[model samples]
Target: MGDVVRAPWDAYFATGFDTCSEVLRGRNWLAPDFAWQERQADTERWEAVATQEMTKTLSRLNAPEHTCQRRSLGNLFDRSTVQRLTPQVEEHVTRLLDELADKLRWGEADFVSTVSEQLPISTIGSWLGIPPEDYPHILEITHNQVHAQELLPTKEQLAVSAEATVQLRAYFTEMVRRRRERPGNDVLTGWIHTWDAREPDRERADEILYRLTMFVTIASLETTATLLSAMVELLLREPGQWKWLAEHPGHIDSAVDEVLRYDPPIHINTRIAAEDTVLAGVPIAKDSMVHVLYGAANHDPRRNENPDTFDIRRTGTHLTFGGGVHYCLGAALARMEARTLLTQLLKRFPTLRTVSPAVYAPRLVFRRVTSLGVAV
Candidate 1:
């Protein structure tokens, strides 16, 4: 409505919520696959997303408590909490790199299939207590969710999502139950303490946890992994960026941030207007769907200088993590993952190279790599 133009509320109101409308209205377009009290978690779509679902899911979990749940377990985002968690992340990145370096016996290897995917899933999965073997299955769910309409997930996709949800809920429910019985140092255990016995909607707590887990799992998966891969891919393509990063290692953090803006893992966000509104002087009626193009916003000449360049030194602001109350909560984790993974790549595989002919994610929403073959 202001700095960013949300979906066309009136257009959404006119066409109603559907695949196309969801893309257009961006605001509150519920996932049709799964049912939520608010935006129903689209089971089919979630299944197809592989990764984007994760990024989107996490965003929803951390969304305002008042709207979705009376209470949310977003303490994971507090600056103090992030600071405390950084060390563990650093260790994980280092260990992951060492593990990769150990496997580089062959002269050449596909880094994307090997190192890039391993870092985020391993780290994020460990945080949530999910076994590494489960990464592929969960990732598949995320892929399905994001690409549901295209893959046209038949009844089979819905069936898989349903069965998977049951399995996941059973797992989390048992996990939550055990944590409540005898809590541990894990975040889930801590979350159980605050999330226990959601009085008004006791029954909904299960769904809440389900959605919450989806949020953490899906959000971090795409942003962190994709961004990490994108960074390494770019360095290989430009080559010079590697020299700049190596010479000015101190700038890696800022470089990661710039890359996020220059080639954001997420390109557009869909929002459905809560009511009638006008955006960028364009009049929109109630319930219109709006597509917030963060990629475009980051490059908006009005807000930035030389928006086309990928200068790590460039600063100001961008909606890479979005804006306003519903902004991404795991931005810190995403940043940490990207920075750490990038650092590990430079150190362990200084001569890392991409296989080339990489493909852009076929979606109009989040921007990411569908396939990027790289060497280690």
Candidate 2:
């Protein structure tokens, strides 16, 4: 355990294994505090509708509301549900791999765009009841939302993303309405049924729909894409690991976990202290902005020996998925996606190698390579 380190912008960063773990499990809000909000507002960076709705999202909510939302929607992503959907996942994986094979035959292919990005969107889009035609629109919005959060985005980029957020809310709002009128055989319909049956008022019904839908669309696609891309980059960089995987298919799960630990898709999880608390012997003041560096925490030496090494056989839990009540609801879904894709990738393209230099995205909270050129 270590003392919390103060950062430049009135922010506190909790590092090490125990410190960050405690902060995540403690009373905290995923959303920034009033001070941070004021700073964003002062700079005209705050999108009111997006900010407010995101606060109610599954990851941001606390207490009975979070519990209720989690329980109501939990079945949609339960073990049995994911198992039932395995064939669908396999279908997407096979199609994407086939496409990649074609691209690879033509010399080189951008793995991130061709495979890492499309699979999650197609799989999650189908689950969300999004029409195939609407995926382009939704993917555009997700890209805008993700890019707008860069370490140093331009003013114009912020404006564009704000508009995208508004559009995303509206899109979901209408989607929820349609689902209500003629419920479908998809996850959104299940969510609509759960929310409407519990909260009948039309306005609250709409609110529930918009928030959850937005959260799911962004969270599922972006983080999983990042994970997939990073996994490919890491494995390809260490060709030995690739050969090892091809030889020992049983280690695929460990490889996924190792990739998660080595370069977690989500690097930093922002939390605001709800009340005065002590984390790992560090006194945290109320309303303090605490950055639980999951990336750092996962790599903490205390938590894992030789933390810097990318060893699939390494043993220990990692905080790639946060701890306690807010642990990722999509953990299983993400794991399945990575496992299916990586297993198929190793089996199909055992000799796949990078054809171009890796280029990383300019973002701190998330880790993603902009493009990964590869060939067999």
**lDDT of candidate 2 vs native?**
0.80
Candidate 2 lDDT over 1-376, as tens digits, reads 3547887876788888788888777655444533446554254444444444455678666677778877877655788888987899999999999999998888999998898889888988888878878877887787777655553457776667778888888898888888888977877877777787899796987787778887878888878988998888888887588998889999889989998999888888778877777766677777677888887888888889889998888776799989888888788999999999998999999899998866777778766677889998
Off by over 4 Å in 2: 1-3, 28-49, 147-154
lDDT of 2 at 32: 58
User: How displaced is residue 149 in candidate 1, in Å?
Assistant: 8.7
TM-score of each: 0.76, 0.92
Q: Which pairs of residues clash in candidate 2, taking residues 3 or more apart in a chain or in different chains?
A: none
The models' CA-based lDDT, in order, is: 0.59, 0.80
